[model samples]
Target: MAETRVKSFVLRFLLAQPLTYWKLLKYIDVDIPTVQKTLKNLLRNKILEYKNNLFYLTSKGREEAKDLGISVFNSAMCPECHGKTVTLSPFKWLVKEFESLTFERPKAISEYDQGYVDSTDTVARVIFMYQLGDIEGKNIILLGDDDLTSLALLASGFPKQVTVLEIDQRILNFIEKKAALKGWNNLEVIRYDVREPLPDQFKGKYDVFLTDPVETIGGLRLFLSRCVEALKGEGSIGYFGLTHLEASRQKWWNIQKDILEMGFTITDIVRGFHTYLLERDDILNLELKVVKEAPVEIKIPEVDFYTSNLFRIYAVNSPQPLVRGKVDWQRELYYDQEAYVTCP
Candidate 1:
């Protein structure tokens, strides 16, 4: 089953671009040895040609892909920026429309657990959610709203109700004030922490839940478990952001396994989907611009490297057993060696 899945994925991906082994490794979820064997099989079958360490589909492979009803060549490829991960190709129009939306940026405070993507990314996310049939009249709950996603959903006149469960009072206040200013009575904000049990009023009340959780294993588990508690039974959808930078393949493997064990199956992983805005007082922003000369003269790279992949998971059944009792909130969330950034 895994081999068949890998074969179909490779055939579909080759229609997008010629792939190097390393690039394929980054994107595919399978083990390297398995990928090697699959590549060998395709090569032996005269389906692929590997040159300069990059893999390309042969004529036979293209014909096979066509027979399977997959488009072998794309005429709409962007000539200037010709890659999936970096270029905002299919989403460019939506992102441009999102540029006009406005929201207050949350202050970077680890204590309040406040870190957010900008309005553009939030709109991009909202658009994706809408595309997935989560539009107007469905009940949606936001596990956290540092990004003010509830406001975005409300502004679009979609969703029957937008409930937010947040630990930060500032965010709660801001969302309420903005929602009122827009005269959107459907938006609701509640102060709640994932470390504690989900409120009775919220349990099994939502059609969907959206979050961008802390990448720590415990943190993610706690956050998502709460989402499951809030979600309605089977077919309820969940959306969250997970990054390759902070979570290694091993961590991703473990997280995905845990999610499936809890009855949600991953449906889509849109790569490089979340882009963060740099703020003036952002710690990394300040560090990036500073020129340091001590044992070495070093300057930060002139590029925005911060991003997260959008993961959409579907509930296969009512959420599995809930993690009873309050989680230890003081647990070391960022101490893991796989943590990409240092945090207090």
Candidate 2:
């Protein structure tokens, strides 16, 4: 997909500039024959029309670009975080627009946009409910107002009644106006601090509940436990955590463990970043950065069963030798174990 995009970009420019053989071949990373082959393919497919030595994108190609362009969205430089890159999904776009439209005035939301708090991903909000299958007419609650996850659900023509429980009235008022403007019959906004136990009226009445708690705080357990408390026997709860450089996958597992212990089934999984649509390639094995700083005389630490109750690797220079001449610890200790997985 990326290659095709790069080729499309190069073609658009070449068509505009009518790059000479030398310049076309010299300026772009792709070779002359390769660029010519792409140009020929585009000409054959009627995506680009060649007349004389000049090439131009055809009406069909222009139309297609326009259609694809509908999915593109822009942000105002993220005024706070200064993170420039953003994902290109339309659903993700609407979630962002919906949230900004819904919470443009709150002090907390202002803080969030300023990066005083953390930014949340809208795609993740939808996906959590989406991965669980249908929610039409299902009772739902969202603790935070980032992108109005529940509001998006209402607009999707599903979720019978969405009860958004938020602390900020300015945010709530914004959502209420949005619901009224859209004529959404099933959406409701409530003012409540989710940190407290769920109100008596909400207990066992919800079908789906989720939280994107105050970022970086340890309030996840409390919020999740409240969601669990408000859920019916078969209800589901989803929550998100902000994991920066301090945590690893093992720590995420610990988070999952804690959630499971709170009495909700922890089966489905989703991962995302604030502004960027994350990919597997983003995870770098940064162990070398730490290892490069240690003293020369220092020895790699051994796995202490209790102390290293997380992922473990025995020191290569341990005091004791293996029981036999050698032992395959990788296979014996954690083959196929997810907790100890290396990057693929």
What TM value does model 1 have? 0.69
User: What's the TM for model 2?
Assistant: 0.47
Give the Å shift of residue 19 in candidate 1: 21
lDDT of model 1, residue 304: 41
Model 1 residue 122 CA deviation in Å: 1.4
Per-candidate local distance difference test = 0.70, 0.46
Model 1: CA > 4 A from native: 1-103, 110-113, 278-281, 284-297
Off by over 4 Å in 2: 1-124, 215-217, 235-242, 246-253, 273-344
Put down candidate 2 lDDT per residue, 181-208, tens digits, no spaces.
8888787788976545467787677666
Give the root-mean-square deviation of each candidate in angstroms.
9.4, 19.2
lDDT of 1 by residue, 157-241 (tens): 7799999999889888887887787688998899987878888898888899898888778778888888888888899989999
**Candidate 2: residue pairs that collide:** 137-160
Candidate whose lDDT is highest: 1
**What's each prediction's clash count?**
0, 1
